[model samples]
Target: MTRLVAANRVISTDGKEIKPGVVELDGERVVNVSALLGERPFTEWLGGTINLQYYADEQLCAYKDGKML
Candidate 1:
């Protein structure tokens, strides 16, 4: 099943806060990225626990650690 993860900030491999984006996943594969302008597979970043930050009303909301954020 495909799932959507809403996040305020995404930590890159270089440990940088990228942008507020949505990550779409089909199981372990990242099928889409909202910050990035195309639909592609991010295979390297797959199959691991993803740390995500959530925001509500322009404020920090929650932090999650999991495969689906």
Candidate 2:
């Protein structure tokens, strides 16, 4: 996951504050990010649990923890 903001402004909706902008993805699809990395600053957020065990043939294998989820 990666977060980016336009210049100095953060992305917001409905006057709700969302800072540090981020993009969360599952496989190739995007998912919720605000609740996902709520604890870290948006500019400093990284997927909390990632265990990439392999990289081959331009493919990757990753894990969040034991049992694959």
Clashing pairs in 2: none
Lowest-sum lDDT 10-residue window in model 2: 4-13
Query: Looking at candidate 1, what is the lDDT of residue 29?
Result: 53
Model 2 lDDT tens row, 1-69:
533211111232233433433434355333433433344444433334433333345333333433221
Q: What would you estimate as the lDDT of candidate 1?
A: 0.47
TM agreement with the true structure for every prediction: 0.43, 0.24
Q: Could you give the C-alpha RMSD of every candidate to the true structure, in order shown?
A: 11.3, 12.7
Q: Each candidate: how many clashes?
A: 0, 0
In candidate 1, list every pair of residues with a backbone clash: none
TM-score of 2: 0.24
Deviation of model 2 at 56, angstroms? 29
Candidate 1 regions exceeding 4 Å error are: 36-63, 66-69
lDDT of 1 at 47: 26
